[model samples]
Target chain A: MKSKTIKASATATLINELDKALSDGFKPTLAIIFSSIKQDWKAVCNMLDERNIKVFGATTAGEFIDGDIEEGSIVVMLLDMNTAYFKLEFLETSEKTTFEDAKKLGSIGKKTFSNPAFILATGGIFIDGEHVIDGITEGFGSEVTVFGGMAGDDLIAEKPIVFTNNKSKDNAIVALIIDKDKIDVRGIASCGWEAIGTTKTVTKSEGNIVYTIDDKPALDTLMKYLGVEVKLDETQEIVAFLNSWYYPLQLERENGDTVIRATRFANQKERSLICTGSVAQGSKIKFSLPPDFDAIETVVSECKSIKDNPEQQADALIMFSCVSRHLSFGALMQEEIEQVQNIWNAPMVGFFTYGEYGRSKIGNNEFHNNACCVVALKEKA
Target chain B: MNQNLQTILDFIQQSKHLSEDEKATLTKAAKDADKALTISEFKLVRTEKVKRTTAILLEETIEELEHKRKAIEDSNNALQKSLKELKATQSQLIQSEKMASLGELTAGIAHEIQNPLNFVNNFSEVSKELLEEMQEELEEGNLEDVKEIANDVIQNLEKILHHGQRADGIVKGMLMHSRSNSGEKESVDINNLVDEYLRLAYHGLRSKDKSFNAKLETNYDDSIKTVNVVPQDIGRVVLNLITNAFYAVNEKNLLQETQGDKYEPTVSVATNTMKNNIEISVKDNGNGIPQKALDKIFQPFFTTKPTGQGTGLGLSLSYDIVKAHNGELKVETKEGQGTKFIIKIPII
Candidate 1:
């Protein structure tokens, strides 16, 4: 298998780069695009469709290209493989149908591929992403490799767009299924943030809206920890939501793996927290501090361990890095991405997403926020 | 750019192509440069040592602060525990004090009322006997009109005797309420105790509120054998729960009247002998406790009544009494519906 990555700021530039990579008797079987929301997604989809290329992608907060990360640009990874088969599926989801839609996608992939590596992307603003994984895992079981991310809107906090060659959808999940006899897929999800303060139980919650923590209003408890005066009557909803990016709730799963969920929105009138994903009532959660320089090292190290496996040669790499990491690391995020780039020195493409989806070391597949998920696909020789 | 340094640099630059004697001079200058580098390295090491020491001290101080914080937290927890115990003791003392005062007043009233009650009983009996003797004389056909009037007097005396006995029963109940139990266990009839308290509580509330009335009901299992308990303490618990039940129904009744709704206020006391325990339940159809306040109903100083109406210690003290008897007190309630307090004491 062979792959190539290209970065472009405009449609023409993107097409030009694609042309260059598709030259020399190379015909891409699939193209994975991660474009900024500012780019013209319709035009880009039309251009790829004209070339008879199968396309799957979503808009991103920021795109990762070559060895650098850039905003307002598009990154595409085109794969030219010998024996692997690729299938794309899209399912529209809403608050009521997210789980069933995920299950439907899973059942479709199960019937289509014998050995499948599933890649998924969905809108980040609504829908409990955790239950989506639950539904898929229910159908595909724990043995199937599942990895993906929730689509982002460049920190605009609006709806994000996901697309296949046929149509673009706002609240939908787009999946890429890879069935191969000789390709090996592995992934790692890691969050380097440390928990601060004491653990608190979710006292009152319904779905993704948490009304109380430790029997206090969830918003008030969070504000108390942040040392910010809780202004219930004031218009501080936006500030509260923005401030929550630094202190996501870290929930430990029954299997001993931890997943972080950040507050996507705040209800001022109700004084509740709307998380990126659902948290169970009575679940113990801890507020996590922002990642320091050591976190950069930890992520880089995790990437290297996967990339430097002597037994397998990595051919393609895809990353779902949480946008909160960008806010936490600032310019140092570049070095962290570069360090991972140095590991495989291969074709890589990714985007900073609102939430990431991957399996941890000791747990089943999970959806996470404020963490980095790295997927490395290698072709067995 | 010093003269000596410049000469050394120039010799090193020219040393590659120089003779052995010039190379020897270059070697000497190189050794001097090595010495200067060593000196700088030593200075850096010393600076790093100071920084390392300072960092170590800071870490130790942070550790000390953490320890102190934990100590303070533990101390605060201990103090909070002590405060809780103190409050409980205060509540117990207040309840005991209230009972003591009520006992003193009831004892004095009983003493004063018993004297007149005895006289009423004695005089009524004497008057009935004299009326009977007159009826005999009338039967002998002498003073028939006088005999008829004596019959009316005897009937009135009988009425006075019946009412006096009823008042005496009430006085006895009040005296029992004021009596302190010695915590001695005895095989007491649970049915009789519950029945007595039900009437006492109902009449007690009726006396306080002229309009308050409730339909009191009881269902006692005939097969229920007597259980060992401190009769006085158990009686107090029964009375407290029954009184609350009446109060709840009365409140609901008042509300129903204002809402133009007809509701029959009812309070029921039931006893059933289970396989291993005796279950006594006091149920009332009244405005139930709200959900937020339900969990704290048995807590001292928690009450829904208006000020000066309730001490809020009735349920709390009753709870302690039941718990001390190795029994469990449980309540099930629904807002705007009713509440049921169930007490289960082990047969053993």
Candidate 2:
């Protein structure tokens, strides 16, 4: 099996680039990471002329390369790992497959492979990617770990793309299969945000739109909380913060503040937060989470500690940081990257995801938002 | 020493010769340049490929999205159509409800008119017999007997005419109730209208339940001149008030009967000319409206009556008509006692 790593330097042909890279080395397997302002799939196809190698990739909110971050550029990495002992599974579906389907799909994996990993396309926007991932988890059932990102657009409420082994379509879900004994794979996921403020009551809501709060319109309630009138453009800014800092409620009994997590927002006349999950009809809520650096540092520390386990080792770290946290700590983004790099010495790749999800470290089958969840993949002993 | 090779390479150099280490460094330095060139060439060849793929994918995506968009649009149209239909149906129902109540009232008036016609027929036949007997007595030259008989005939005829006139007044009131009054102000004999409305209103109550009865009093300002007012409209107002009072009294009576309490329900109609206006009141000695329902009494479509019995528009329409006439309609009531609706229409 032949493997190679090919990357872009300027605006040129990816075919020639790949051909040149493949010419010198032994035949190699490929793993490409491309970040471009424009659609570069044609260039990608030039690289994939031969169906000899399986491909898996995602669009990044921002791409990192050469020890620095680059926007609107494509970075392709083709490894020379062997193609033997590895299998690639492609999932294409129009009908929304259920947990039963995910389990059925997951059951295809070995009871225990020397090294087994699963990558699924978490829906980019509006779709519940976590639920999809959870379905896959049900298939694996603590047998194998899972990792992937809900595909993304340019944060455009416009058309978003989800790539599979075949094509990109609007109503499509995809999953990639990476077999055991091919590569020692590692995955890390985190949003790097903490719960702060007081919990709020989602008094009256319909689907994703919250009509009233404490029996008043949600917009008025939020304005009263902040003690300022919200302008139109600022609505998105408010919603983004609300999604990151509010709605998936939790009670802080000592302070009497109920935390809320905003799952989605209904784009109606009155913009409202679609809570991550349903709230009880009369539940009281508040915006409460400590905006402390120590809270963030703790996540970094926790992610690093996963790497120290003798049974597990880190080869690659994938971080899906919440876009709100990305915006909140604009200049501090590098610090977050650095902190992670210091902890887990591995090749890191991921995006500033629109929303982040993973099972809570606190426990339960529940997925979380606002906070970074780390998934570390190590070769099986 | 290698100038010949360098010069020759400069002239004819395909420049492919270099050590592995040197080549590695050169490729590393030129990776970005190499990547761009490869991207451009790859893009040209792959452009066609991407176009086909994108077009096909776009068609599929747009088709799916269009299907969804169409579904949403269709549903919206359907919902709007349904809403409009609902509104139309509601208005039709309200109009039908009003017509139904009017039908019931007309039937009651027809029944009331039949009673007076019977009286006129009975009295006319009795006078015919008395007249024949008087003629025979006159032929026999008994003048005293004839005089007494003649007197009796005249008295009986007067009773017939009096009862006939009262029946005529009630029939006229009922007829006016059916007609939408011009509501135009005219020189109205306030005293007479009060007197006429009193009888019709009393009859309206009696028609509802034969047992229902009320006392009426009038202290008309005989000295005061007639006022400009809509007599027919005012009469209907009085009629409605009386009917409502009768209902209240009837309800009280029923409740008392059930409780074995023997208390006769009484409604009183009174009229007094004040300084600048005439005040007419219909008071019922029955359970008054609750405090909560008081304010809402004049609101359209509000009723304490069971369905099919009241249209609930009487007071509301009366309120509106009175307001238009620049008159005041006021109600004073107490629980377990009585209620009085006072109407003060000004005379200008």
lDDT of 1 at A249: 90
User: lDDT tens string, model 2, B212-329?
Assistant: 6555555566765687877766666766787788788889988998999987777777777788877878888889989999999999789999997787887886787677779999
lDDT of 2 by residue, A237-350 (tens): 433323323223342333442222444444335645455344445566654332344456766776665554634455445565554454444444556666775565555555
lDDT against true structure, model 2: 0.58
| Pairs with steric clashes in candidate 1 | none
Q: RMSD, each candidate, Å?
A: 14.9, 18.0
Whole-model lDDT, model 1:
0.79
TM-score of chain A of 1: 0.94
Chain B TM-score per candidate, please. Answer: 0.61, 0.59
Alpha-carbon shift of residue A347 in model 2 (angstroms): 2.3
Q: Residues A65-113, candidate 1, lDDT per residue (tens digit)? A: 7558889988899887543476888888888788888888878878988
lDDT of 1 at A80: 72
Question: Candidate 1, residues B100-177: lDDT per residue as tens digits?
Answer: 435433433455456667767777777777777777777877787666767767676776777677677667766555
- Indicate the worst ten consecutive residues by lDDT in candidate 2 chain A: A238-247
Q: Which stretches of candidate 2 lie over 4 Å from their true place?
A: A1-37, A49-51, A80-116, A142-144, A179-188, A204-213, A223-264, A275-285, A288-290, A293-296, A308-313, A364-366, A371-381, B1-348
DockQ score of candidate 1?
0.02
lDDT of 2 at A310: 39
